[model samples]
Every structure is written in structure tokens, then in C-alpha cells.
Target: MSLSTKSPKTSPIKIMQNRIYELLKQGKRIDGRAPHEVRPVSISTSVIEKADGSAMVSMGGTKILTGIKVETGTPYSDRPNEGVFTVNAELLPLASASFEPGPPDERAVELARIVDRCIRESRAIDLEKLVITEGEKVYMLYIDIYVLDYDGNYFDPAVLSAVAALATCKIPRYEMRNGKLERVEGESMKTPIRTIPVSVMIGVIQDRLLVDPSPMEERALDTSVILGYDSDSNIVSIQKNTPGLLSLNMMEQIIELGSKKAEELRSILVEAVGLGS
Candidate 1:
């Protein structure tokens, strides 16, 4: 008999190798990244001429555009002293192969909810100030987010774009005269916003944690978490994906990394809004 018995067929070995990879905890990823490296981000604001406020943010292959349109309206009955704020998100089919053309899906709804919570709960915009009257008059802020491209990690970039768009947005000045409103034009004015909230996503694969993972990385991830941070670097909102459990130490590490990323992103938003010197 031959000393090497035909290597026992390479096909079975290949299958075993694949199973080992799936079961084992690899040391590092193929990209040679530490799993915490965020992709290069590019952001710009006031891109849409028709929108009162608009911004676009691109991270790797993911691209998001956000626009804010503010108008006068009546306040809600429950919150008589608060203005109205609404968020709508769209995943255009052009963005990715998976996105279909139609009304918003569950993904879109989730995106909108995350971004909306980050802003509303963070007190980024002063809603009480938006109320012009007890219940009759108030300002309505409508934020529209468009996913022009999808590579993964859509929540962070979308929220960032929304914040930048709202920061750069200029609402028309209206003066109330005898229960009538007149548009005031001359110089521009700022919206009634108090702070800015930034969002970042972290991907966990085995022992590695990746920040701003690409589509492939996202697909292979065991879990993904999103953390929304305010200008003060305070946690505004946290959304977790996947049922996989993480240790407290891992959570702390991710928090530190996310906070750093959020501050950097917030600076970008400030610059886009002309708030940064």
C-alpha cells in the first residue's frame, strides 16, 4: 500500500476545513484590520437646492442623503406646547440589489425609528421653542432620509446625515399678524435646535469587533450594535441586533470606541452646519 493513501480524497478535507472555519474563533480578519477600524467617511451639507436643509454622508459603499423641511402647523393636542417632528426613511432600489421598489419596508421603519429617537430623546432640537402658540401655532420639522447606496451600517451614516441636514437647514421666518402669518425674508435664521446627536454601528464577529463594517462583513457578523451619542458624548440611544450575547467588558470596549467615533463625526456635522470655527 502506498505510504500516503491518496490523501483520503481532498473533497472531504475541503468540507472539513470549511466546517472548522465556521466553528473556530479566528484571530483576525482577512482585511488585516483590528475589527474596530471605521471606514473613511465623507459628508457634505446643503446639497439639495429645493430642500430647506440637506446633507449627504458616504461611508465606504454606503451613501445616505437627508433633507429637512420645516413648516408652520398646529400643535398636537397631547403636547400643546411642543412642535411636531416626523421622520421618514426610504431605501431606493438603486441603492442595492436587495432593496425593492415600493413603499417603506420594515428596515426603513426601523431606520427611521432609530434616527428619530436619537434626535428626539437627545433634545437635539428644542421642541418647546418651536411652539409659537399654546395649541394653535407650531413648527413642524419633517426629516426625509434616502439610502442612495447600501453597503451596510446604514443607521449610523443615516443619522449623521439627518443631523447635519437639520443643522444646516434654514426655516422661513414668519411673522404672525392678526392671526395671519407673513413670510419674512432678508437674512437667514437657524432652526430651534439645542444639540446634535451622532450615531455609530459596531459589528461583532467571533472575538473581533468591527466598526463601520462593509456589506460582506455585515452579512457575516454574529451581532451588530448601534450607539447614538450626543454633543456631550452622552449615550442617547442604543439598539442591538442579533441574539448573541456579549460580555460586560466587550460592551465597555465598544462604548469607548463608539464615543470617540461619535465626537469625530459630530465635529464633521458642526463644520457642515457652519457652527465650527
Candidate 2:
């Protein structure tokens, strides 16, 4: 036998994936989880030694690492007194076979945009507070997300990871005296923030819609919808990229589901961040 030949006792992961897909067609899952039930999620914070703030979120077998870095800079001309926030996502090759090593691909860019928009456009951060000087000094927040593992439904996990990191993030203490800037080390405090936004995705396959779909379920779906909700369960943003039509009734149903689930997920984030409310 050739050295490259496989042994008789070989395991086939693809076969199992196909089997799971077939079972899903029969309205069942191999793990007995309901179609809408999300996998178990575990979250940890302050993992990166260098970043100002960091977090690691694991949803089932998927793992994502997020870091937040805050720097002082001049505010954008359009928003003189307001600070700026930017999000970047990197899906390393180690995370999954589909991802490659390079700059952010379209999927990663879309993911970052969705997460950034939900927070930035929702007026969650107190950008005015970030202004150390009127149109002179402002804070710039850079959020980086690295996917360490791949299971399924990476979008939700990535958002949660970003938020967790942000909640624990600390802004460097700076003071301007006589037009001179000074940085205070180990004396920084939490960044001023406002509302909390949560993102939830639903998959539409044929006539049925499912929440928290696995990788296989995602591949089988006609399209997917990502709904972002605020702490008050108000819809903030909606992004749909698939060529599928959604009825008003279906949209209503998804909104209700997404709102309810967002509240549930917010509780998890609150506990992770040790918030009073």
C-alpha cells in the first residue's frame, strides 16, 4: 500500500455532516436540539495581554477572540466633538477550512460592519465624553475580532464577543494642561457608553424559519436575516443579503422572536460584564 493511502480504520467527518443534513430535512437534529435553540455559550474576558480590553466567546464548538484598543485623536470633521469607532474582523485559517489567511474577506467585512453599525449607529457610546478638547482631542476605538474556531453561526458570537470586550474596555486617562497632553497609566477607567444592542440571526429554509442555525443548516437555508435590537427590545437595524422575499407577517414574527431572544442574550452579557442592571 502506498504511504499516502488511508488506513482501513479511518473516520469520515463529511459523511456525518451529510447525515445531519438529512436528519434536519426530516425535521430533526442529531443532538436533539430544537431548530431554534442556540448552542451553549461560554464567555470570558481580559484574555489578551496587550490589548486595552479583550474577550473570548465560545458558542458550542466555535470560539472567537475580540480585543478593543482606544487611542486619542482628532474627531472627524463631520462630527467634530464626537469620537470614532471602527471594527475589523479576521477569520484565521485555523478557524475553518473556508477561510484563508489574508485581509478581511467580504464575509468578514460584512460581519464587522453589522456589528459596528449596531453599536455605532445606535448611539450606544457617549462620543461627546470621548472629546478631551473641543475639536482638538478625541478617542478612537478599534475593535479587532479573530475567529479561533468554527462551529456554526459565527455572526452572533462575534457580536457578543465584541460587546463583551467593549463592556470591559478601559479608556486611557488623559488630561490637557496648558495645551499639553498627558497620559495616565494604570489609572484609566471604563469607557462611557449608553444603550446596549444585541444581534440575533434567523435562517429561512423553504417555508420554515429557524434561529441559531448550525453550519449545515446555514448552507441549506434560502437566506438569512440579522436583526439588531436594543435593551428595550426596540429594533435598531436589519440586514438581509439573500435574494429571498419576506412577507410582513413573517417579518413581524421574526422581530418578536429576535426581540425576546435579544433580551435573554442581554442578560447573559450583563452577567458576564457584572453590570448592576
Q: Candidate 2 residues 137-193, lDDT tens each?
A: 888999999888877677888888988888889878888988888896668878776
What's each prediction's clash count?
1, 0
lDDT of 1: 0.79
Scored by lDDT, model 2 comes in at 0.79
**What value does the lDDT take at residue 35 in candidate 2?**
62
| lDDT tens readout by residue for model 1, 202-234 | 876566566776554555566789999988889
lDDT of each: 0.79, 0.79
**After superposing candidate 1, which stretches have Cα over 4 Å from the reference?**
1-33, 186-188
Residue 257, candidate 1: alpha-carbon lDDT: 88
User: Which predicted model would earn the best TM-score?
Assistant: 2
